[model samples]
Target: MNKIELLELLHQEVVPALGCTEPVAVALSTATAAELVGGAIEKIEIIVNPSIYKNGMAVGIPGFKHVGLNYAAALGALLSNPKDKLQLFNKITDEISKKTIELIEKKLVIVTIDRSKEVLYIEAIIKTTEGTARCIIKNSHDNIFLIEKNGVLLSEQKELTILDNQLYKRLSDLKIEEIVRIIDSCTEEELLFMYDGVLMNTALADFGLSEQNKDGLGIAHSLKKLTKNDVLGDTLFSRIMVKVASASESRMSGCPYSAMSSAGSGNHGLTTIIPVVEFAKYMESEKIKLLRALAIAHTLNVYIKQFSGKLSATCGCGVAAATSASSAMVYLMNGSTNQMGKTIINMIANLTGMICDGGKIGCALKLATASNAAVMSAYLAYSDIVIPSSNGICASTPEDTVKNLGRVSKLGMQTTDKVILDIMLEKVMNNN
Candidate 1:
């Protein structure tokens, strides 16, 4: 891709999002369907691809104090703004919550399994006083497909076809040396532009720490303890991750407000930001340096996910955040391009298999695992215990390892992703 193309890709990949992507996607689909009828909705019937179901099960919606597809569906009907894309359900208020609860009490939400096509489909039907509205999202989380009311088509599109040879596949085909050159040579202005990430992500941490929204992991508290106990703990970056993760926990558990999301997840954003920011603080790095590091980390994540796709069978945090952290660690250590390669290899070797069950408290465990691996891999790379190409799935060099990693993420784990989703869906259905 050329410079302009890369920039466009970056803009698309780094857009902001509210709540967890899964539930929000649910809300978007439902709200769009509800909007079609132009009246009070009475019932919602939702069918999801397995991965969507898995993610919806774990992550919480903002203001719902719950973590499943039901509340998300209700919130979509009560508060969704169809124009807001993935943020359609951002209008939740006290009155709305009460109304949503009343609807839920009526047992109005229904979620079903659809075992066809891609792993990221959500179809929502809203039955209202006027009639029924239906909306469908396919492939990507927020790509709305069909919308209908009273058996009449309200939108021209009925299905969203998955684009073959997506961006990640294209990026994976490039040489790592070319990518490193682009990252290293960027102007300070471009690099520092991403400082907005720090500001935005910090806001989330603060919100999560507030007494009103304290359901998720206490990342802020953890950071404070880490800082207080260890003299090195007072670094700005550590504080950032703690804050970011704490807020993510809150948001994932249903806190209101949006987060600056990378590739459709606030947690992914936190994973990218907190680790990079912490490393910067530890090094007392300059703003330009931090930006470059963050840029590299974020871009690396975007690049990896290009192959892994948006919603993957594996946890994207392990791939995106871990890769970003590894790159940031290299930048912090002032390690050369080769060291960067080593760090990436180490990260892939360590975290390529972390399953993404969904977005919930348990995701924090995956985040922590990936973040710790990033730090360790960075430290290891600096120490020169890099994995050789002779090993299983490892390339002869570090860059080759990245390609191998992408292959594993995109191709090798395909069935694993499906099987896991099927099992989870089966359990949900059996229990229901």
Candidate 2:
């Protein structure tokens, strides 16, 4: 791919998103459907793919103390501005929250799994006193493909077809060395977007650091305690873990802040970007190198996800995205393409199988573990230590190992996703 076209791909893939994106996607679709009807919506019927339902079922929505798709859909209908995209929850207010809660208590919303589609699908139907509206968002989390009112078409966009055919094809085709060169060749004008990512995600890290979390489990809190007790003695590795995990903690808790996301996930953004930034700062690397490294890190993430489907039963943040962070850290340490490749294989060989049960506060713990593995693999590769392809499922080449990992997540993990969802559904039902 031409370097110029790669820039456009970067702009498209990296974006700011609020809350857990699955729920935010839900909010966007319901709000769009409700707005078209233009009145008090009496009922909402929402059908979502397994991944959406699996993710949205447990994560809390911003500005609300509850968890589930019912509340997210109701609030999306009540307070959403279709203009907000994935960040729609940022504008939620007290009155709207109260009204949405009332709607929930009255049992006016229904959510069900859509067996018709495989991934990233949401179909919302809203009925008001005057008429009914329907909206369909599919494939990409932010894609709004179809909208209608009273069987009259409101709009049409080919999100599903275009995303899979054109956009993803270009992204998936990019080579790792080509991606590194593209970042290294860019001017300062081109890096402003990445710097914006540094500013946005770091603030969330600071906020996460300040949280007085109970159970001693929040990433910042836990890391701080470990440092104080002298168990984790390396300040550099500890700092990297704290910064990356803190950001995940903030985002996973619905901190009401939007993260500059990579490949449709805020946690993926934090996992991929913040650790590389921290390593640069600690080493006093030049601004240009710092910028280039971040660009490479994030692009590496998007590149990997092209093989590993965007949504998967496995934790993308830990396995794929953080693996990118490890490779970027290797580059910052002056490791060559061979060393970077080794780092990629080393990390994926270890962390490839972490299951993504759901998004919640506990996800920060997994992010911290991934960050540790990222730093460890980088250091190991710097010393010429790597997991050879002969070990287990690792392929001879780094990119091939990544492909193997993707195949395992996308194709080899069906029974895993089903078992996880079954357990989660059982718990939710038992609680209710």
Candidate 3:
């Protein structure tokens, strides 16, 4: 791909998001529909694909104590702003929270799962005193395909499918060398926006490591305390792990801060960006080099997601984003593109089987693990050690190996995904 195309891809994929993308997408859909049929919202109904239901079932929503799709939809309908998109909750207040709770208590919002829909799908229907409207977001979060008001179609974009198909095709065709070359060709000024990710996620890590905000799993907080006690040495690996995990903890616990999401996931952003940033700090790398490395990391993340599909049973943080982070780490070390490819091979070999149950506070542990693996894999590749092609799922080329990993996530693990969703659904039903 050319430089402009690569930058466009980064702009599309590496945008900021509040809360988990799944629930945020639901909110976006509801908000859009509610705005279309302007009036006092009487009810809201959201039907989502299995992946959305699973991920949005329990994750925290930003600035709200309640968590789940119902609450997200209620907040979205009440906000009634499609333009706010994922950051719809950025300006939420106590009155809004209380109104959201009132709507939920009245049982005005309903969420259901549709296993037959696309992995990233949300259809929101809102009923107001004036009329009813519907909105459908498919494939990517915030990509609205259909918007209707009072049973009449207000907007429908047929060209989006063609554009999305072409985008994925171009992404899947790229090789690691070409991606690195694209990064190298860019001026540091053009890539300076990449540092925003470091700043945004570092804020989250700082919040997680703080003593007071102990809302999440506490993985990062505990790890930091261990370092203070000298129980866990203040090594580069531990620091990177703690940083990434702390960010995840803060995000998963519903901190109001936004994360620069990579490949449609906030946790993926933490895995892909924080490790490379922390490593750059440790090596005292140049700012330009750090931005270049981030460019590589985010671009490779989108490339992997093109093959893996947007959501799957496998943890995208481990297999996709961390793989990119490892390759970027290699780039930061002045390692060859060939070494970057080897780093990817090492990452896939190690993290290929990590399952994604769903997004929750526990995801902090997975991000921490992925961060550690990224460092280890990068160092191994720098030392000229890599998993052989003959090994399981390892291919003669990194490109092919990535394709293999995607196949495992998209095709080989269908049953695993269903079972995990089934378990989560059963628990929700039992609680109800």
| Candidate 1 residue-pair clash tally | 11
Q: Write the per-residue lDDT of candidate 2 for residues 1-432, one digit (tens) a residue.
A: 666776787787788888888898888899998888888888999999888888788676766777789888998998749898988898888889888889989999999986557667899999999799999997778889899999999788754543366656776766667677777789877876788888888887877787453322466777867876679865888887887777777777777667888878888988988899899988799888888888888888878887777788989998778999999999999888788888999988999879999888778888889998999999999998999888976987888888898889988997898888889889989998
Model 3 has an lDDT value of 0.89
**Local lDDT at 70 for model 2:** 89
For model 1, residues 1-432, the per-residue Cα lDDT tens digits are 554455556666676677888888888888788776777877889898767777888677765666688888888877757788776666777898888788888998888877664547888988888888889887666777777778998675543333353555555666656666676677776555577778877777677677676475565565557777664375444454465457566667666667767866778888888778777878899877887788777778776766566676778888767777677788788887778878888777777778777777767657766776788788888887787777777776755676677678768877887888777768777987
Off by over 4 Å in 2: 159-163, 211-219
* Model 3 worst lDDT run, 10 consecutive residues: 159-168
Lowest lDDT sum, 10 consecutive residues, model 2, at 211-220
Q: How many backbone clashes can be found in candidate 3?
A: 0
Ranking by TM-score: 3, 2, 1
Highest lDDT scorer: 3
Candidate 1 TM-score over all chains jointly: 0.87
- Ordering by lDDT: 3, 2, 1
Model 2, position 419, has a per-residue lDDT of 88
Higher-lDDT candidate among 1 and 3? 3
**Per-model lDDT:** 0.73, 0.83, 0.89
